[model samples]
Target: MAQVEMNRSVQTRPWFRQITPAQWQALLASSLGWMLDAMDVMLYSMVLVYLMSDLHMDKSMGGFLATLTLLSSALGGLIFGILADKFGRTRSLMISIIVYSVFTALCGFSQTVTQLAILRTFLGLGMGGEWVAGAALITESWPAEHRGKAMGIVQGSWAIGYALAAVVSGLLIPLFGWRGVFFFGIVPALVTFLIRKGTKEPEIWEARKNTRSDTEKEGSVIKIFDRKVVRWTILGSALSICAQFGYWGLFTWIPSYLATSVSQGGAGLSIVKQTGWIVIMQVGAWLGYVAFGLLADKIGRKATFILFFGLAAILVPFYGFTHDATRLLLLGPLVAFFGSGYFSGFGAVLAELFPTSIRATGQGFCYNFGRALAATAPFIVGTLAKSMGLGAAFSITAISFGIAAILVILFLPETKGRELT
Candidate 1:
């Protein structure tokens, strides 16, 4: 007990100084998986303009494919979350990486939109599963006080992956074309072996297994919907729905919007330039994720969500309405920063909200179930863009952000500094 107290005292220091070497390894492992996962999943979005021309797809069809991936990812997250709970997180993480890697590489072989969508669906399975496993693994291992910031590190890695995709797309799309761009996704799969060798199942998970009754030890996806858990499940899912919708709707279209011709109502940047712009925005996104973690830890989760969500609501229209490249260059980062930053809170909050047995399942279902519904946003935005223009379609996504902010305040309680066990 004295040793435990001493450990807790040490952990109360500055965030980075507090984590043990083992904790750092876990963070690195989770961050790497997430970073590469983002690269694999986001490859489709980054290369979307090229896919449109190569596959002869239009705005609606393109957005439909993005929606399809999200829908599939919901299934993936659910399955893997259950797996993480019942089997083990490290095992599930490796499996998910392999699943996404194989499917993402196969995407290069797709001959049509139908074929590509099918490959993306399989890829989404692994992509979504990795998050369930990785987030659960990190949250369970770290102290509750710094869990948000740790999640921020994991979530922030997505920006690194996003930027890497953009950079690679800018170079590869113009050189070997779209097929070559997807092939890079196969590289991340190599890290699965490292994960297998380096990481272990969380102590919290193992401790629960050793100490609990049969009823407590047994894992079930349905357990989250129990009388006491149902309200939390509902509120988390609802908030996630708004965030996912706003996110998928905007980012899915932004690259295409930048690359499209001014005559067709786009910003009219070249592919190379468009990729550069997206990369710059991802820097802000990375900071946003990191900042959200630190801020959530300091000010509490609910207030952090309000600040970021409010900024997102305000910036969506400002970004959408701007025509000049100069203005876009200035406003894009702020828009991406606020819009993408709140994600750091998602894994932290969901992990805090449930028991060790149900944590992964609860996080996966809340986040990905919302993902399934939010999947429609891209298609809706795409269909609307045909008539309203991409600017108008994007501007309208602010409504979802507004709703998300309200839900955070009204429904979800702050989980800051709450002990995980």
Candidate 2:
């Protein structure tokens, strides 16, 4: 009977209770940082129509601005990856929060598209840095067996942030205009205090720092390309390129597509209705992120990663071609689920691919450099929309999704339960 009770207890044990208090703090801080970072970043997309109308910007111009932010963010990711390896993750994270917050708010005060463009460029720097620091922090803090689940929770918070941005836009845009929505970007800066008070650098990073040789101390970006790591780096970047292309190409224009009149080949949703639909869609995204992590931990990263991409490939086209309003509403969550969930695997697989010495630098480059390459996605989609309409242009993401699944099958190896050495 005692043995039976022991087995039952083990079966029923909550995953959270298995980690130490310090791990919990790391998870919480990273989740909040990622969540707030997403909220601030996505606010630009949420209010894209208002900005274009007020600033007299066309789709190409708007897409160019988004592209610029992404290019700068790629640079930021590379810089912060080295910083996270050299400085403590907590310190790097704190500074990044301040940088993006201040710039995001400044975007509100811009009278011209050029001004908003300049501010958004600066905001991209911190937006890129936060992920490098936060991903490293969580990967190092958690045990290998549970890392996928931990990263899943962190990535899942992105959906929550998106939903929050939708809610904020819905409520405040009516009262205070798009500027009011941007002003709330400053609220995330306050989260630095909680991070400062609650979090500590991962002990693994501290130990690695203490034992580092002169060359290793620099956390040189070139080290990521050493023969041992170069293959995974290239493969990782390819995967990132496909994923980012599919995501930005589709999402950047989804709001505009929804709000445009049916005569104009859109859903003709009011801003409020579109916002509500977006919020509901994020529920699917949140579930996708969490489920991807759990499934990755169980079945191995390669298989689970491919699964999401495969489903996304099919769903994106279906969602795009469907003209029925009710069908689109019902399809939103399913598309979001398969489209966005695979992100949960990225942190784990990338973190696993490199040693502790250059994990941040390697993963950062693979992810962000790919981001730079994929930066063309929005512009391409926008340019295509001018000719083919948003639905047809948006459906192009399905091809990108299919490519991602194929890449995973051909190149990415199983990295399940890989310890971050």
Candidate 3:
């Protein structure tokens, strides 16, 4: 009877109490992988203006290249998702890091638009793969109770990477030119070594590997869309599309929106001011990521996402109408808080929902497919900006948040405290 009581007590404890040191280490490694991944991708956005001028490309062509990157990212996500499930999350992550870093540096050597476009496409492929593997790695390693916080920390790495890119651009773009900026991009490949040395396959995945039959061991990508999982696949894809469209559409153009001359309806801030604002805004984004994780953990993923999205829908439009620098300084954080915060939920929620057999594949498909849909954001916003104004172009972004909020409230189920198989 005493032994039975002890067993019951163990089973009744919250999931957070179950985490081990090894799981924490896995989370850190995956977070760093994701952080560096963002650094590589954000570098392109930061230096895109200069790259366009240097390559003699127009806005339309620039938009086209961004679109190409997104499309290729979709392909990469699908391919790597399969590989990650078939191979191992750690191996897939290392390969992706190497691929993106090499091609990102190669971008520095490009003399023509064609060359840059090719490099960006390859970079997108690697970029798409990294998140899928990293998210799966962290999800499978950590306990369900703390998974939201872990994923939040992992997602928060994006802001660090984005902040780093801004700093690098502000420091290097003036001295070494954009080419030098691309040169620095290659440094992220060093992260692969840490991953290769320190990380191991999660025990869950190891057990799954050992238990699998010959057919199951094959781990085909087609399994992700099996009847049981297809609804989740579609839901994740839709949510990702909404989030990415709003983010890339509004934030990608914001620096230009702020720095352009008044004739273009911009604030005409100097590069120094632009960089300062950009970096500062990301600080809010970082906080939002952390906060969203905690909130999702406490309340529920669905509830927290709805709250953030609702706030975003209200705040984003207001962000456009205001012109006071001091007001913007105060409001920028809030904008980032709502615009970027909910992303943290994806890693935790998606990881919990999918089975280990197709976890990475599901993550990649949902995320990269959303990116592909979002690839149109720049183009759509650019066309709107050309006709109406930057302020009005941003209004469209608010609609995306509304859509996401509704979908989360209506469609996505709460995943907090759920065990990942």
Candidate 4:
């Protein structure tokens, strides 16, 4: 009777408190992988000015490099999504860490713009692949009722990684220069050891693998395009495209915009000051990720997504137009919060959309292919900024965000609390 009562009590507790050790390990591994991925990837953006000067490149070239990375990341996502399905999420995640980490460190040795570009492209593969495995792992590990919160926490680690990059750039750029910062990216490679020790593949995936016949394994990729799932794939990709466009366009240039002179249509802050502001802004993003998850669990996924997307559309233009130091500081957090919070919903909704057979593959293709299309954002913004200024270039993200909101309202189904198993 005591044991039964204790089990009942545990079940009644809040989701965080009720999480098993295995669930916590999965969450931790996924969060660390994503955080390190952001740190490794964003180091380039954080030191873009240095790269431009050192490599004797122009803004278009700098933007093109970012674009190249995103395109490669898209390909990586597709390949690794299939890998995660076939091998295991943990194994796929481990391999991706090594791929991005070694390449990122190699970037420090690049002597020419061409070499840097090639290295960055390789780095992107790991960057893009990490999310598919991490998201699928989190979805399978956590309970259905609390999956949104789990996704939110993992997504929120992105802010932490971005903040770390800013801090590393601020401290190291003056001391060791951009090359040293790139070298530091090799640190994430060590994280694979922890993941290998602490994490295991979800039982759901194992059971599916054990029971599957040879014939059933065929056409895994093609299944995403089957008649029943095709609509969700289309709509999900559309939504992801809009979100990625807004994100990559804005963030890829934000560090440069903040550091540029006011006469050049930026806030004209110092490097250290810009880093501080970005870190503070990410605090809001972290909050937004968490709040969005809780709200998603309560109000439903589509509603929460619509809310964040619509607000982001409003906030993007406002943030872009402001050059006043005080106003820019104030608006930065709001922009980050609204602009980024909706991402948490994607992991949950996408996982719920597909079955265990191809969950990673389906979600990976939708998100990364959309990312591929959105890869144009940085180059377009750079070209536009050369003419109109960075502020005006940012206003375009508002349109993307607006369209994303509409896409969710018109087509996507609510997936809150949907059991993946």
Q: TM-scores across all candidates?
A: 0.97, 0.96, 0.94, 0.97
Candidate 3 weakest lDDT stretch, 10 residues: 215-224
lDDT by residue for model 2 (49-151), tens: 8988999988888788888888888888888999998888899899888999999999989999878989999999999899888998999999888999999
User: Distance (Å) between predicted and true CA of 112, model 1?
Assistant: 1.6
Q: Which 10 consecutive positions of candidate 2 have the poorest summed lDDT?
A: 212-221
- In model 3, pairs of residues that clash are none
- Against the unseen true structure, what C-alpha lDDT does each candidate score? 0.89, 0.89, 0.84, 0.92
Clashes of 3: 0
Clashing residue pairs in candidate 2 are none
lDDT of 4 by residue, 14-74 (tens): 7679998999999999999999999999999999988999899888989999999999999
Please, what are the lDDT tens digits per residue for candidate 3 over residues 290-310?
Answer: 899999989999999999989
Q: Give residue 228's lDDT in candidate 3 (0 to 100).
A: 95
* C-alpha lDDT of residue 148 in model 3: 87
Q: Against the true structure, candidate 4 has what lDDT?
A: 0.92
**Best of the candidates, TM-score:** 4
Best by lDDT: 4
